[model samples]
Target chain A: MISLQDLTFSYRKGHLVLNNLQLHFEPGRIYGLLGKNGAGKSSLLYNICGLLYPQAGQCQVMGFNPAKRQPAFLRQVYLLPEAFHLPDVDIDQYVRLYAPFYPGFDSAAFDRHLDVFEVPRRQQLHALSHGQQKKVLISFALATTARILIMDEPTNGLDIPSKRQFRKVIAGCLREDQCMIISTHQVKDLDSLIDEVLILENGRIILKEPVTRITEKLSFRQVLSLEETEAPLYSEGALKGYAIVAVNRREEHSRLDMEMFFNAVMVEKEKILPLFTR
Target chain B: MQFSFSRFIHLCRLQLAANRKLYLLGMAALAGMLLAFMLFFLITDDELSYNTQQTIYMIGLVLSSGVFTTTIFKQYAEKSQRTQALMLPVSALEKMVLAVLLTLVVYPLVYTVICLSCLKVMNYIDIYWLGNPNALYWLNASYTPGLLIMYVYVQSFVLLGAIWFRKQTFVKSAVMICLIIIGIHAVHSFLGRKIIGSAQPANVEAVGQKLGATGISNFRYDGGMPYINTLLTASAKINGKWDTEYYMVELPRPGFAIMATVLILVPFFLWFITLLKLREQQL
Candidate 1:
């Protein structure tokens, strides 16, 4: 579990990157953090991992102040940054050197994940392509078995098939006590994988809801025109017609479209805000 | 704050696994340089005395120690490496201890072994091939204690600089050390002039005489410097016989004590500062 209370952060003195934000995360669910460029998604992840300290308020994870970076706290949380450098060693050697640091490291699971990703076990990490290296890291991160795993842009550099494999591995690796917060701009990579959606805008979280709740509250459909729907909250043009988001008045079941939902939330925030908040 | 011994051992093993190649290559290079220097001197110099050998050994020790110490925390200089290091589930204290062990203890020991081994080989050549009767003895030197203490004192600054600078650690630390030495000398000179009036004697012998007259039995004059004389003995050769003579050199007890204390304390102080800096580090 993680909690942030009025957390404020800024790289420079005058300009705030993450302003007085309050948020909480629970275990046993995957949170898809959606935000625009420079929306402080990576900054929030760093704050939770103790790489960056908050300027104002408390950011606590598993009852420990992340900024302290104590061993007990670090052992339970792992942050896979957007950019990282792996040592020039084979995967087995790398795992041998680092796995002992985590008490709950599952080598069997690591091997299974590697097999799932189809990464070679004997090649040096630096010799691999960037995508292969990312796969190796992803496998290791999953094997770490930390209670909270915060990944910044996990699906980047992954091919189409690898992306699907990544989603499968992540969904398979989740335990009842584990929580994962993934921040990425590529919403499609994690369409059905994420259970909760957290939309960050203007230095704070504007929307945080479960996928089921979101689908229940609003109906996503293709309409011929704006007049075809009654009081649609948000609408966008599609190839066939227009995709519209409207209040679910008749209990009609519809699958959630993340791209349309994200666009709707960003464009018509004023109209969508009342539905989620109330 | 929770430090498990097994975890610390694991961290040390990890460090070795990652950097063993670099360490071994550096040591090999140092060994080659030492061998070349020894061979050149053995062939060129007519009389390679123990004093000359000791001087060369001391220089090698200081240079290598500086290089090793300045690179101890080099991983923290880069963002990616720093993240990898700090995110490891080990306490900062354990990391610091491992660094100190590698740079201060292991490096010096390995360098000394290599240098001594090279000298032994050179000695064999001198005796067997060159027909030189008096071969150099690598261990017969009075410089070990002083050199080691000085190594600790100097390398502490370099280690701190490695964590502090983030770039050009060796050059920046050298410049900072020079500035510190000059600052201390200037301050000492100014304070000396203020305490002992400007009208005092210009030479050290006169100052020693004045101090002697004031019942300062520990005071002595050596090379235009006044020092506290802790121990003094003299000998002379007269008519092919050695006889007891007047004092020739002096040793200052207070100055030596202060020097010893600083040499003992500064490394720990620097290490503590480095740990605090590491704890506050952000990537």
Candidate 2:
């Protein structure tokens, strides 16, 4: 659904932000874009949506060049940017004005999503709270029914219940033809949602694998003590116990901790990647 | 892909909604002016002469142009609101086109209608002339459309200025101008004057010859400053011998189309490209 080849980008001259990076994402899966703050995750998502162009290389969504920004191409893609300012008009007016621009805009679905979230459609968007505004944007994005949706830090302003609602709604609303690429530093919010992991570090994608493969090849555990004799693949001492991820030697399916897995990939990247190789 | 006229209209309407306050104010002022003109005509019972009407139109045009320009800066590209607009699915080209149509085409047409209505109410407008709004004496003769196009160019340039400098754009623009002048001189002092060599006069005879008598000389360059200077700098012997066909004022359709496409469309695309670049860096 998306591809980036040797994409190098920079803000100004002599300052490279994204180095020669290559990435690909297929449909029918949720991919988590993992990185620290300012790791270029948002940049990568924007590039995918053709909101940005690279100094070198190219980016494509579905089968079209995102930079070209053809109407048909745009109709199939959506980008929920970190910062958004909705028009001050009431929600219904906003919908009436913008719905015609998108060929696939589903007004009924939009209304349903709004009702599900219990957002007041008659209230002006600016009068709503931060979380409420987010719900509005998220609901509208989902209603677009676009093939590729790129969200950057979608769960940031969301409260606990709303975050769960967000995850649940996203998981339930997606179709097999749809591909959602979510970039977030908050990994636990996407624990059950993401099926694939795409870890970006030092301007390159260092790891890409499915959650199932990662779990089958490796294991995560909370050992009572850090003084265990066998050295684990990766370990960090937590307050309650030692959090460790190691090569799975037993038959049971170990619950994967997305945060621990991300740190393990960053720390023992070389050692962990080989285990997932088919 | 087929361009959707209805979609364009919808986009135009959205822009109108965004600037409803300005629109309401302009409309109210227009109504008040029309009522005042009608009262004057009714009390005096003297036909408002064509010259007076023309003068009124010109003044109205200038005043309204100023209003539209300022509003465009505020409503379309104010810095505080720009970050919120970067994520819409619409491309920069579409957004720019919508803005241009609203500020230039839609706003001007609405103003012209009000002017004609005022003239009609005052019994100063002829029914024959009413059919062709573009045929108004002052409007046609003064090239209001052409001037509006120029204003649009200036507005788009200022939009670029707004994007480049977040705070105090007017000051930053002055500083940039000073730097460019000083930097050019500094570069010339160090490396000699090979780059932007001293300005020189163009030979009208040579230009006319190259353009085949109807070339550069055939166009009337109304731009006062350097063009007037160039005319003054001409050799006495070469005066009147130059072909003047190209110098006459003509309909501004082609020029407006070309400049509007460039001034509005090019920066718009570049802005999108800039947004993308910034997005990557932000990530």
Best by TM-score: 1
Tell me the spans in candidate 2 whose CA falls farther than 4 Å from its real position: A237-239, B21-67, B70-93, B109-283
Question: Which portion of correct inter-chain contacts appears in model 1?
Answer: 0.59
Worst 10 residues of 1 chain A by lDDT: A80-89
TM-score of each: 0.87, 0.69
Which residue pairs of candidate 1 clash? B218-B229
Stretches of candidate 1 off by over 4 Å are A223-227, A230-237, B39-49, B122-139, B198-263
- For candidate 1, the per-residue lDDT at B275 reads 87
Q: Against the true structure, what is model 2's DockQ?
A: 0.16
Each prediction's total of clashing residue pairs, residues at least 3 apart in sequence or on different chains, is 1, 12
Encode model 2's per-residue lDDT on A1-278: one tens digit a residue: 78889999877898776889888889888999898777778778777866677899978778898766666777788777777767778898888877776778888888877777778888998899888898888888888898988887899898888888888778888889999999988899998999999888767777788889888888888888767635788999888889999888774588779999998988887888888776
Candidate that scores best on DockQ: 1
